[model samples]
Target: MTQPGSTPSRPRRGAGCLQSLLVLAVILGLGYGASKVFGDKDSSSSSASSSPSSASDGKGGSWEVGDCGGPDPENKPDGYRAFDCDDSGATFEALEIKSASILPNAIQCPAGTDLIIQVSRVFGSGDNKKGGGIPTNTVCGRNLTGEHPGDAGAGGGQLVKGDCITSTAKEVACASAGSDAFKVLDLVKEKEQCPAATTEPMELMMAMGRPYDVICGGKV
Candidate 1:
């Protein structure tokens, strides 16, 4: 028989140290298994939540025909799109809903092809893409800023580097001055990219977030 709350084991008058060591090893093994299970759950949930969500009315972001959309980003209703991305005391202008990707920096694909794009249009994520509380371009497109030489327009940490994320219609916006908004008429693939579109599929999930409303050709 064994003492209460104790495992049955061969009794050795002078083996306390050895038994204690074996008990410790068993405890450690059990802890290791528990930690592995818990760690896996955490990793999976974080991976899923961090992944971008599917654009409603569409998944991945191919704006369907008749889908409520703006005009070709190049051509804005008032003229060209404009916005002051941050109050960083930097005086520069650009269009909204454009993912901060301008021509030359934007990915160019053949017209009338099916494309899935990403949008920084997620609101309540704190008006920025670093997944923290930073502004959009400041967070995502600084590398591509015209003011900076050798720009690659990379910011918005919410997105993996070099992934496709926004879209625009190639319509020409009459050049305007001192505005903070514009619109993209049809969906143009948006991403500060290398060459062709991305072959990877971004996962989507329902989020307790809002939409990012910025002007494209006119208004988003």
Candidate 2:
């Protein structure tokens, strides 16, 4: 059974619209195990109160909900870069941004979120700097144009358990139960946890240097 607070099992359709920005990992040595974002207003311990926008040079200057983008290759403090949905470089779509600590579970992400990343914002002069460190936040995203394991193809869709895919690399209803359809057996942090019959292991990458989330699937 799907966990009560976990992402919904239904596969999310791919979007081709150009979307917003994402996480750029800044290793904070504060021992709080968090990543840092630039130009944030929250205190060191809380989540973001607003969505992330690029304060630097990148596509579409500022980010908003439903925008597509990811970590900037330049790796600046405001390292996230926005991208047009049709651009192959656009990897993720920002679904939710909140003032919260980085967590590994799906709760931080929206129901259809396929990726999770955390970022921090440092308090500047006159800004609240409680706890004496940078403020961190969780950025929930959906996989749109990036690559994943199992050769699921670009913008294949969400890889939740019980989801099904066809040989043509299209997501389908598991209830259809066609002989050629592949059924998602489970989603695990490691490939070793997949059942012996599992044929394909799709690796979903996360931000903030977290481990990959693997989706195990096989013939129906």
Candidate 3:
């Protein structure tokens, strides 16, 4: 008879080796499946982080340089809406768009343009409003066509620079001498040189940012 607790024979040792191999195979299979699941999760996270943000993406519906718009309503004081440049009601033309922190002065418009509109207001409703306390002023520009539109007898044509405009009892006068006639010059400011043809320097006030004296010559 065999002694109790003796070392196992070759066949039994072979059985133990088979069981160890099976256990290792199961561990490796489970590890591979877990790796596959975690790898997909990491890839998805990377894709989401790389996506673009909406507000600063420079997409459609955002104002850009050269976009033209006009004030909403017939004579709204506060806001504007985009319109085609050829639209009959269009008034303001955008020359540039910039952040509030870096906005340039209104008088410093690009060469060959003059400031026609300047706006600094908030946009949006309720909680979605942007630029609440922060103020941003943008200067809109237009070509300097000498003719002032809607004037009587202007005929929708350009006017000559330095021409006299008169508020007569009959029809208005252009470039004529009368008690009511006043000369038109490029918008002037106080302390600036008087017009070249000024015969007698007289102080005439026009409304702008503030009432300032523009020296006129040739008539009182």
Candidate 4:
């Protein structure tokens, strides 16, 4: 007997095959969609990082902001020098901790600055001249960058402000450090510090033993 409005099914084998095929198609579609989403995310991230950056200078050198580009004005309370070569005949005053007793190996700025640790040593030429050259470039196994490092500007070093210094505080400190001669005084800052150096308020000024000189002339 034929049932009204009813259709006959194909073989059971065929029905199972059809269902398996349908499941596989759905899986493939979902997989394709998910892959596209993830792929897009990666591409965007790469694009953002590769965008043109002015700081790169298009010449493969990273540009640092606020680089004063020359020596600090002389007579600064704290200034900079670029260590170039060691004469080993320099002289220095011993450094004493009369102003502050900082951490065992910490370099500090006056009030309102964080503490940093940068070390430099002075050398002596001794009366016999055996070891007096304090090459800031290689003073006590450390290189200093003053107006000259490795011959100053002749492939020795790229000096930044405060990279080397000769100051009352520094001179005093160096004198107190028990070094008989002065090498190059590097005014090292905390790595990645900004405004490499700044003029301190006159109130922070201590009496000067020597007058400061201008390393670079301003528009004055």
At residue 105, give the lDDT of candidate 1: 19
lDDT tens digits by residue: candidate 4, 55-130:
1011111111111111113312222222112223211111111121212112122111111111122223223222
Model 1, range 1-220, lDDT digits (tens) per residue?
Answer: 1111222221112221211110000000100011111122122111111122211111112111111111113222211111223323222221112222322113222211111122322223222222221112211112112322101112111222221122221111123212332232222222222223333222222122212111113232
Candidate 1, lDDT over the whole model: 0.19
Q: For each candidate in the order shown, give its overall lDDT on alpha carbons.
A: 0.19, 0.44, 0.30, 0.17
Q: Which of 2 and 4 is ahead in TM-score?
A: 2
lDDT digits (tens) for residues 1-220 of candidate 2? 2221232222332323212223443222111112222222113321222233323321222334565665565544445555655556666666666555544333333234545544434334232221122334555566553332212221222334555655433455555546776776876778899989899765543445333355566877
Span of 10 residues, lowest total lDDT, candidate 3: 22-31
Query: Which is the leading candidate under TM-score?
Result: 3
For candidate 3, write residues 33-58 as lDDT tens digits. Answer: 10111122122110111111111111
Residue 107 CA error for candidate 3 (Å)?
Answer: 6.1
Off by over 4 Å in 2: 1-22, 25-63, 76-79, 83-89, 106-108, 123-133, 146-220
**Model 2: how far is 158 from its true place, Å?**
9.9
Clashes of each: 32, 12, 0, 46
TM-score of each: 0.16, 0.34, 0.36, 0.12
